[model samples]
Target: MRRRPPSREELDDYIRTRLALIGIDLSVLPEDDPDAPADQLRVLRSARRVLEQTVPALSDYSLDPQEVPPSMYPAHLPAVRQVAMEEGRPAPAAGGSGRPEEDAP
Candidate 1:
């Protein structure tokens, strides 16, 4: 029997579902935690990379969640979302001008 490949949409849905399990909240942490942003970004990047790299190798036999070996799921999604949220917010200027640096500099 031949195996079918998992569709891109399926992969994306799986990723999102797994990510949701970890509680994707971004507003609670301090912005200056030097390691948080990078760690989250790494996880998000890894998830994307894994999907891109592994999806091509998957056959119909591999498409089934039960048959497919379990990999780390969304261990980093929350972290990534948190960091991204923080980064998205406007940080106060270094001089405390109440304006963002883009305006000052």
Candidate 2:
């Protein structure tokens, strides 16, 4: 199913909410304040424009939440290596897979 693109108001609301999540609340600034986040807003607007132009091409696809992989947490590295050693598989190199790059399929 195809979804409608977000309205300008919706995008602005999303951007503001994202900023607030990071502790920057644009709403508290006086409307006339010269230091208000114009540059950040401009960049977000540009990004939104790019998305509006590009995303329609992807609307034919459906995304399943279960198909998305979970993110790896950096803190689990040591434990991951220990588990690999326990299982008799060689531990992965510091920043590479266990296999050499040339050997990877």
Candidate 3:
């Protein structure tokens, strides 16, 4: 026999319980009123769907913990490197030298 996935209500209850654990109370949200538009719940459910699709895809990548992308550069890194070199010490180990603006004055 195959195991069944959780129902929508079950998942929602799980989310509510988890949120409550973190001090978030979903009960604070206004109840669905027949007189008003259903926009709030619709948007919340849409965001949940987006997360469901996004989280798994994001988890697929095996990223290095020490790896830093080339786009992120610390402004003070060059100064640090210069100080290290002046003191007769080796430059610090970092991803891609972490110095995007080394050539820039």
Candidate 4:
């Protein structure tokens, strides 16, 4: 028989425990702050990056919704989803290098 996939509650507990081990306090997060969505996106992206960079074995653990059940996951799903959506868009190029324009001399 095939091994059953972990339930969302199990996954959430695992994630929370792991975050605690590394000093991240999910309980203190301000879920109602106006900028909470953006902040959550940043945190999730940063965590994903750190895990991928430091533990190559976990690089395969993408946060795609299909992998995570919607019911038992964190309440900030919309924010995390937004982060996933913006993953690879290019940033605007820097202007005129770092030097002052010739007219400024």
Superposing all C-alpha atoms, what RMSD in Å does each candidate have to the true structure? 24.7, 13.3, 13.1, 21.9
Model 3 lDDT tens row, 1-105: 233545566656666677779997656556664455543355357556645556545533333333543356545555776787798766543333232232332
lDDT per residue for candidate 2 within 1-105, as digits (tens), equals: 235668988887777787779998665545453476555556566667766765553532333322442354345555676787798776544342222322211
> Per-candidate TM vs. native?
0.29, 0.35, 0.41, 0.31
Per-residue error for 69 in candidate 1, Å, reads 16
Q: List the residue pairs that clash in candidate 3.
A: none
Q: Which candidate should be chosen as best, given TM-score against the real structure?
A: 3
User: Model 1 residue 25 lDDT?
Assistant: 43
Q: What is the lDDT of residue 50 in candidate 3?
A: 49
Give model 3's TM-score versus the native structure: 0.41
- How do the candidates rank by lDDT, highest first? 2, 3, 4, 1
How many clashes in candidate 3? 0
- Which residue pairs of candidate 1 clash? 3-60, 4-60
- Model 4 misplacement above 4 A: 31-35, 38-105
lDDT of 1 by residue, 1-105 (tens): 233656766765666678678976423444345567544434544576687666534421222222343564533434554565588843323221222334221
- Best-matching candidate per lDDT: 2
In Å, residue 27's CA in model 1 sits off its true spot by 7.5
Query: Per-residue alpha-carbon lDDT of model 4 for 30-100, expressed as tens digits?
Result: 54455665454355545655553555434333344434554676546445545655884332222222322
Question: Candidate 2 or 4, higher TM-score?
Answer: 2
Worst 10 residues of 4 by lDDT: 96-105
